[model samples]
Target chain A: MLLDLLNKLVSARYPLRPPGAVKEDAFLQKCIRCRRCEEACPYDSIKMAHGDWGLKMGTPFIYPTAVPCYLCSDWPCINACPTGALEAVGEKENVKMGEAAIDETTCFAYNGIICRACYERCPIYTVAITLKEELYPVVHKEHCVGCGICEQVCPTDPKSIVVFSAHR
Target chain B: MTRFELHFYKHLNRYRRLIQILSVLFIFIVPLLNKAGMHAIIGTFYSVSIGQLDIVDPALVLQNLLLTKEIHFPLLLAGIIPLVITLFFGKVFCSWICPFNLLAEFADKLRKKIRPKTIRAKNQNAKPQYYWLVFGSIISVAAVSGIPVITLTSMPGLISGQVADLIFYGAVGMELSIVLLILLLEVFFWPRFWCKYACPVGAVLALLRGKNTLAIQYDAHICANNCPVNLKKVSLCNAACPLQLNPRQKGIYPYCYNCGACIEACFNKGGKSIWFTFHPQETKTNKSGS
Candidate 1:
């Protein structure tokens, strides 16, 4: 009786499961621990970290708190994903939460070549880009807000930087 | 006691499998729609014994969706229905429902085409070393990564995705080539070998199979003596289980999923009332007759 009452109360309080909020532990348990998703992430924000949940080792993660989600129009991660672990499509609002990354070696600004086009063209340039006095501009990852503007503007043969979103 | 109650029970008995199948269809089919708009309707959390948790807890497939969020009633049921079926029968889901199982079977044909003639490794005593290797390193890695890396990088998934991508991109000319490669790899070698050895999902399921509330039972007279796994006479029950578990085992583990593959197998063998019990030890029935 008590359990029943408690169940009822819990349901009333937290009725909504915020679609796609299902725990993926069971599926993660089935995962073979490959790095395909990591390579597929346009943001390059995915990393393999096995901690706390010893059972969920070598899985993909995007620490959005460390970075920010930059919505990629064409998600390579979805295209590249093989297992159902990563759904081909997902929520747009949630997808916007994935973080982005930049490789300084490929950034035109790193070569003492002034390429602030990414910063100027970025939708969130103010939050996603920062100017460094060293050579051209140094991107502060903390404040850089991985929007992929740098990646898109990057004149390198093939864009050498990317970002990622938390694929929860 | 009442006629209405008896009638209801009869109907229930007949439609029970139908209900289960419908539930599974509802589960997988609905979530598929979530992909169309990338607007999921389902939430992540579900109520478990240990309070509330993510519906796709473990995030293997949902994480792959990569949409903002999704509503997937079909997916939830599709996933949970297998467990439900196991609780009542014996890993029937593996034989009938699993898309992966179907894929593996499809690949089996292709694998056979190019499969190298092999020296059947003497069927030796299997060891627990593979289990340790599985849980110790691979599982730990998945836990840390918050995703199942095992199947993602799998050659099969990669190959399939490549073929699908080629088709999706309208590279019509490339489709035949990719299909041929996939078919050759899948049919020529071994049928469902990936599930037996490579599939962690299979591993998890095998562990849970014996615990099934419903499962297969042994009949001594069928083979006139030898066990089903003796792999000689063809029997439906033995052939049904995706794991290829011997239906004639003593006191099967309690984790078995009640897929009725064995029952169907027995039916083909001219067995009777094979599916007599809904749960373990509920009824003592000799379907093959005295």
Candidate 2:
């Protein structure tokens, strides 16, 4: 019965939940659908998913293009959660919401252009992203928290550096 | 037989509307405070915790119970405040506090005044929507597996929170549409449809009220004979009720929000027939003394 619900939730195009969201299955069960996280989000990064489907209703999620998590030091979204759907992580680097991957086809830095926008805007610049000697941007997946700031600041029309949600 | 105290009824009526307006105003103010970095002073639609004390919606508590399959003691205790209040007072939240009800009431009046010909849906024998409780719990179990379902339909929280987000951020996301649709539908289809038949929160509150201990008691003698002038005129108490419930009927006690509107109407019309009181025995003596 539970697996049936899980399959239904995953079948849809799932957006990334907040930074400290628990594993998807646990998050589904624990979230009371109170939407306090949406209220607490400072940047208005969190928006409740709206669909008529009974399974996807009133859940908090984020679309990077609209607003990306600012990664506040206090982590208000997690603190505001009454249920432990979102848990506090020991370090911001450990708050693994997703992974950022660079699309070589669209990346200006990769196309021999002098663009280091992603690296420059990276919240965890030195650790998660770095610039090579030729000024090419490289994303270190291991250290990336995937807060999506780099994606938001990407100069490409559609971001060359996109954060793939770890949730799915 | 009893006489309604006009002054006391007037005072209660004034405060009831005052509380309702304040609660609705605070709905907008809370999100702004949240934006200003005040973490301690926020409560969601499901639960409201101020400082240390918490008061949760009992319907949501039931959902948690279905999902977790065990009692979360802190949440249970948090829910007790509203439950205990409901047990004693009977559905006061619907009339005097819930922001959605206040808006719906205003919408109802506007519809009546602006488009008097609009045919409002009427369910004369409306019963508490128990199916919502069953469906809500089933959704909670599914949510436990994957999917947060109830927040989509929790009108009070969704509307107020979305309104707050709109004011603070100047962004109206798709979530606001559901609430807007309900309000728009209300202008034509049903006046107070959600609260009257479908609100799970109202259903839970009605269930929590074990007996009609604190409710409006009708004095038939006074209503029929004490004030001939009131009887000659149209029934103000009946017309004043936003829910369109008859306060003069003992059967309607469970649905009465103790909003004091009927009491005010009765007092104003020199009827003094319908009065809200706790002890039936005490009100008789108290009314005679007054």
Candidate 3:
């Protein structure tokens, strides 16, 4: 449908939305681009999409490499939303921002370089990321909330582990 | 009596300027307060929360309702304050509170300074309908696209949003350029053409007016007999209007934001020809009855 195409065009970047963000199409419809969530963020994780985002401009997104969501006990961003664009998730662990993926070819651990940075920095720790034979860190995708702490703390240049937006 | 009227009229613009400055400052202050660990007040012009009271732009609310095809009580509740304000005040937000209007006023001043003798072509007759057309098209585009496309063109929202971005992120976004481009156009080519013809926010607010809405009322008897500017090519009030509207005309209501600029101009010229009336039509009826 025309609506579907327009939605896809606007949200083409599929930027990592804040925690408890509804589906992309619904979020675009509901979000008035107020930036309350961006200001409400204690960790400065939420950022408004700029003009480069076209129609998605002013909508909240997170560039985890610069400042990853700290995954606060209470989602203040969701609470601050005037519209329900960012919905409330009952439990913090239940928050699904996106899913984290590790590129094995470029990973330091895969290249025989000792790196446990992502595992140590993961908010969920052993649940989201675990060491394989006490050497390689393997991401447990289901447990990963995609807070991007691993992507932020990753030692690799291109980010050995990255969180792909779940909405995409 | 004349001196008192002049003093009172002069203060309207002064008060309007003060409010405009404060609204601009409020945009920055809210973010600073939030950064300083006070969440009591937050947000931009698109939506703002002062303590427990939330005020969302009614245009945004309408667009959201259309796009999502859902009834959201909280969102509707947030939009009521602005809706009610527009109903009574008749687009006063466009003149008084909108930071873009304040900026456009400066642009108008600069345009006059740069080209002092240039006579602006008046197209007042065609503007209100054009503005409504623009508003209608934007709403239709929003409904079809299933996106709140109006937000991109909402000047006050963009200005306040960019200001918040600057304070929070220590840098402004590319949206600031859109505002600058419009301002550039205002300075070089058209003066306040955006607000007069294309601002969907102001258009929606202007459309909310009824007979009882606060509006400019012209007293023809005062103007015809006593006004100093009557002999001049253009009356003081008509010349003073930023939107180039003839204040003496009967149908300037929809385009006029009740800014009192024309009223102030009339008072400055020692004429009591124009003033604001809460119930314009009713006041006329009462005068005839008496």
Question: Which candidate comes out best when scored by TM-score?
Answer: 3
Give DockQ: model 1.
0.08
The DockQ scores of all candidates, in the order shown, are 0.08, 0.39, 0.76
User: lDDT per residue, candidate 2, B1-290, as tens digits?
Assistant: 32335566867767887998888777777777877877576666666667657667887776666665756576688788988888888889888888888888888887798788853322232333443455556465545553334444677777776666577668665776777677778877777667765666776677765544577777766777776453433556666777766555434544556787878887776676777667653223222211
lDDT of 2 by residue, A113-151 (tens): 889777887788688998878488888988998888888
Chain B of candidate 1 achieves a TM-score of 0.48
Top model by DockQ, which number?
3
Residue B215 lDDT, candidate 3, scale 0-100: 82
Q: Tell me which of candidates 2 and 3 scores higher on lDDT.
A: 3
Q: What is the descending lDDT order?
A: 3, 2, 1
**lDDT tens per residue, model 3, B211-253:** 7888887766667778675434556776778887776655575
The global C-alpha lDDT for each of the candidates, from Candidate 1 onward, is 0.41, 0.71, 0.83
Model 2 CAPRI quality:
acceptable
